[model samples]
Target: MKTSNRSCPPCRSWASRRTSRTRFSEFSPQEARNERLLTALTIDQALDARDAFAKALYSSLFAWLVARINHIVYKGSKRTSAISILDIFGFEDFKENSFEQLCINYANEHLQCYFNMHIFKLEQQEYAKEKIPWQNITYTDNQPIIHLLSKKPVGILHLLDDESNFPRATDFSFLEKCHYNHALNELYSRPRLNGPEFGVRHFAGQVWYNVEGFLDKNRDTLRTDVVDLLISSSIPVRYL
Candidate 1:
């Protein structure tokens, strides 16, 4: 498979031979806006924005590579046989779990659920239906957990995105919403009402994810200034 990385303007600008920040008219409207937004950010916010941009760029590159590979493989081809390889991260429990860990664990939960339903659940139902002699097997049914993490409207991911839509939503507010919707759920818990961390009980173990940079990471935005700067042109990283 061919690989290509979609680099940001700021990165490209830094590598340019002759770098300078010209007038606003020299840059696109989005680039000017990006610069303004970036200049206004606190040191912490700027750092978070940087990471978010990196993740976004990686996601875009991965998507482009997948699309390109698919196009090459499937263009005018009749499918007779196909093979797919699945490789994904496993459940994680670190001292400080964050947005990435939360998502990874959620995926693991779904995989486990799929196994339980097919191997443990469906098999038993079929056996009982056939009236065959068998032992009643008890498995850890993770339906409740699957519902808690991904159920409609109130799922954690859904709630995060919903809060992200609001211009003023903060991590604390997101946490509040999470706890508010899942107060009765045994699988979810919070040490404090407005804490930076929330705990979830997964099939493997319990994990607490910090919500500090969750919103910014979820945004995956690149300021216009960044695009303009990274392009083959002058971009002012520091004001004169």
Candidate 2:
């Protein structure tokens, strides 16, 4: 297999070359308007955005490499049987779980659901297809919990994103919406006295998440000024 490399434009701007010290008040009205259009991220916010982008880039590359390797090995194989190993992060619990932990746990739930489908549902499917008589084994199916997390319009992630878009939104409001929309869901709950927190009964176990910075964490906006500055700087961080 051949990999292609692409060249990116070099950064040439002073803002991109040096640490940002520009004050918001110093910006012209037009610059301020552009900043608003880009969500006017602070220095810390810009660094966080870059770090997130780097992580996502590496993860995508890893997945692509795995798939490519599998394709290469399977293309000319005489034997049809093969064994594969996958390593994924386990469910996490902390003194204060946040959005990232929620995502990690949700991924674990999805993987568990996939395993159940293959072990239980698929086995029965194969038996029926082969006309073999076999007793059906009962197993817990986590479709409802998956739906609660991923269902369109009413999913927890969608609700969080909706709340993140509002300037006046707070963690409390986000929790309130979660409770209102998913009050009847067995997997979802909120403590009567706990401040701005919610619980999800994941397949692995129950985990409570603090919603203190959920809205801000979900707001992964990069200011246009920052982007332009980076693109114009002589820094090594070039976008291809």
Strongest candidate by TM-score: 1
lDDT (10s digit) by residue, model 1, range 1-240: 532343222233233343223322133232464473213455675666566546655565555555556656885765423336587667899888899898889889888988999999899999999999999889998878888888899999899999889999999899999989998889998876556888899899888899988887787766566555556434332211
- Candidate 2 per-residue C-alpha lDDT over 121-215 given as tens digits, one digit per residue, 9 for 90 to 100: 99899999999999989999998888888798989988998999999999889889999999999999887686778989888778889998788
- Give stretches of model 1 more than 4 Å off: 1-40, 71-83, 128-132, 192-194, 228-240
Pairs in steric clash, model 1: 9-229, 9-230, 10-230, 30-224, 31-224, 31-225, 34-224, 34-225
Per-residue lDDT value at 77 in model 1? 62
Question: Candidate 2 — which pairs collide?
Answer: 11-233, 11-234, 12-232, 12-233, 13-232, 13-233
Per-candidate TM vs. native? 0.72, 0.71
Worst 10 residues of 1 by lDDT: 19-28
